[model samples]
Target: MTPDATLAARVTVDLDALAANWRALDELSGGTASAVVKADAYGLGAARVAPALARAGARRFFVALPDEGAALRAVLGPGPEICILGGFAPADIAVFRDHALVPVLNSAAQARAWFAAMPGAPAGLQVDSGMNRLGMEADELAGLLPLPPSVGFVMSHLACADEPEHPLNARQLGDFRALTDGLGLPRSLAATGGILLGRAFRFDFTRPGVGIYGGAPFAESRPVVTLEVPVIQLRDVAPGEAVGYGATWTADRPARIATIAAGYADGILRAAGAGGLAAFHAGRRLPGAGRVSMDLITLDVTGCAEIGPGTMVEILGPSQGVDQLAAAAGTIGYEILTSLGSRYSRRYTGG
Candidate 1:
């Protein structure tokens, strides 16, 4: 049966818009722009997203784990380059070699392990720069001197690229340059935010992640995901009557409330119901009315005349993008996108 025929919420992905976002970022990159498809392309399903990106001219892809790289390799075949950003693990060496995955060595021990097991295998280097969360420290690099020919590139991540004027941006840039300069290896220090920070940060290649998935830091990005939830029922409440689990919202006058078939379990953050969140019907904003429960949400749809049982309410689309929804939930777009649950009947269009 078709998705709309059921009560299931739906997530529609626009591959054309996704590819367009990549092309736009690539144009600004001034170098190759690799796609980061980790976390299943930010929970949108990497199997489909990666191939669409490949067709859009993304020759390199990045994932967060060795298993993700293996899964991507199966879907992408053998042509595109897949790099694992989680660094090397002795346990993952077989997976890496079998899938031809490149590990971005993040420390001296990881570097030593990788070089010893697969001496001439393709690999990349991730220097800590200023994001101490991962990558090799400046002092650690001294021990791996004269990186092998297989070490194709050197890269670092920016902690403040989104905040362009932050002092850490310049400091990290200088640190990366000092660490990798004169080594003559290709360098990459930018992701979506750094790409927008301008050409200097776009060394060798820029890895654009959330921006390509229709998130912020790339304001011009095309809307790529549309989420619609079915309204299971609608009820009228007299003035002063409360709605939902906690009785947190009450009708000041007579009201029509819509109970949709989705909630936090479906990745709709409960905090959004605190206030200022709304679902759309025929372009009209139907503000949320009460505490978002585990499996449902109540919307104050009193004035939306066309809304009724089975009416699909838009949660994410042209009327409200991912970032806007995230703001209402007191979180970031990355969390919203990645938190998208598996219950939705997903549809893909326009590759």
Candidate 2:
């Protein structure tokens, strides 16, 4: 797609890094990494992301809601199982059944609702490890559970997997182990962080969500996403010239400034302009100048005279990895990845 057809913004998902990241995490999982493609593959296009993962040898996938599962199923060609991590809404049973989606029964009420009326369908149980985000409580699980015959996969979430040595890791491990030991079901208790925790967390199936797309699933993961933006307009500004909204930045010297076509509305956080980043071309460095506007960013391009309008600047790619971008934004890479907008001329690199 032509860059001009876009609305002054673009979001390219590096599928190559995604697949590589998945493979790395899979190898870490002893070759059992089922990617979590929820939230549109963290806003990178689930249809493309899920299949890209499957091509990288991932068989299972997870999504948050039945609708997300349905979209994943559509993208993956109808047969690979999608575990609905959001469980089921009171009004969503028919939708789940219609889409052949597996609802991770989080509550006894949901389990009983499905078991009593639906008779048979593939379903799973989600145990709340330390996250307590979603899943069945331990006290709630012991009262003689009602599980479907087609319990294809069982799972849990890890709240502290990023900090491998966090005490909650072992506590969650013990709790999850106490709950699912020899349950005769394919159990998964690890997200990206949990996978890095160790082989102990690697069950029959493991879901590495953020890691696959390169959001540092583990604390030490090499970054996976690299985003690039284009320089739109370049002009000379006097030392005292004000830049962007609220006149927040004043050029320290006579500066050649290049405007970048990205900002908070386009997912580049506002903090990215607060002296947090460096824009570059080829190998030359350029300091970001002025406050980030809703649709543009200014970079002091004084010494780098070669870069001009249409020159591409690295946003979050090989040159500017997500960690640096996160550091620039005062947030984590996961937030940056998931918040990426969908208006780019998305190009899938590698396989």
Candidate 3:
């Protein structure tokens, strides 16, 4: 068998689609579009994804930590801007300065620390607006009026931009405007969802994260990932035979069972088994037969022709995207994508 065909599972990342998604979002932004490579580009291997994005004309990237930014700098080799969304501490200043990372100061304290340690350095200001998760509150921002010349831009996150019609979207927008309307600084208030909210939220630049990775809130984005696992064994189960832990599934009649070489350990959420998840073979849907184990899952593959050990089964692919898989796992697509295990043989195509 070919090297890839022999693998128990594989994750194929279409860098071409990823770059296209960024271009699409960038076009929609009406301004500059920055890539969010945080969490390893939402666990799709930022080392590869960031370069593909940069090649597609992306000039800025965002990460959640200083280390992530520093690593990306090494891979990108300078020129592009790497901003840290998680802010920074005194200890992190060295990493930021050495790597030329811009910190999105989220609080008065963080702002003070950045200015005190690295005066005249480029930094971004993050106002909370209404998320109450990060960034300086309106009152807090008011106290720091007349921001330093070193502050490169002002930004805020949308709490309900994905919902579009969510009242909080307008509320947050109004709050963001109230805090930054006359700042005369380059401002950003949108990510993927916020970009979809229309030109009103695009501001000066937009950061596109999950949407660039083929997740929701960017419904038109091209799918970027496909996952498949090999069926390692096949067996016939008699009626009344129970399968897997807790005897959760029982055969009602003669059934052909295929044991695939993947499970929760492979980032297939255990909850998916109970969520009526299924595997696909040659366009045929095969319902899962039992609970997902640490390294294997049994699927009812009866009536399928030409099936046996070494046959590959589709888990997340053309028939089932990440959002659909996330629904089956009772989680969000971000969790599904970021949770993917390292065991899969990852293949990249069309950068």
Question: Which candidate, 1 or 3, would have the higher lDDT against the true structure?
Answer: 1
Arranged by lDDT with the best first, the candidates are: 1, 3, 2
Off by over 4 Å in 3: 1-7
What are the runs in model 2 whose C-alpha is more than 4 Å off?
A: 1-9, 217-224
Across 1-351, the per-residue lDDT of candidate 1 in tens digits comes to 234456899999999999999999999996499999999999999999999999999999999999999999999999899999999999988999999999999999999999999999999999989888999887899889978899999999999888999999999999999999998898999999999998889999999999998899899999999999999888999999999888999899999989999999988999999947899988888899998898899999887777777889999999999999999999999999999999999999999
lDDT values for all models: 0.93, 0.77, 0.92
User: Compared with the true structure, what per-residue lDDT tens digits does model 2 show for residues 198-281?
Assistant: 788888878888777666645445555556787878889998988878888798789888888887777788887884677667
Which candidate number maximizes TM-score? 1
The TM-score of predicted model 2 comes to 0.92
Q: Which candidate is the best by lDDT?
A: 1
Residues 129-239 of candidate 3: C-alpha lDDT, one tens digit per residue? 899999998788888887899999999999988898899999998999998988899999999999999999999999999999999979998999988899888889999
Residue range with the least summed lDDT across 10 consecutive positions in model 1: 1-10
Backbone clashes in each candidate structure, one number apiece? 0, 7, 0
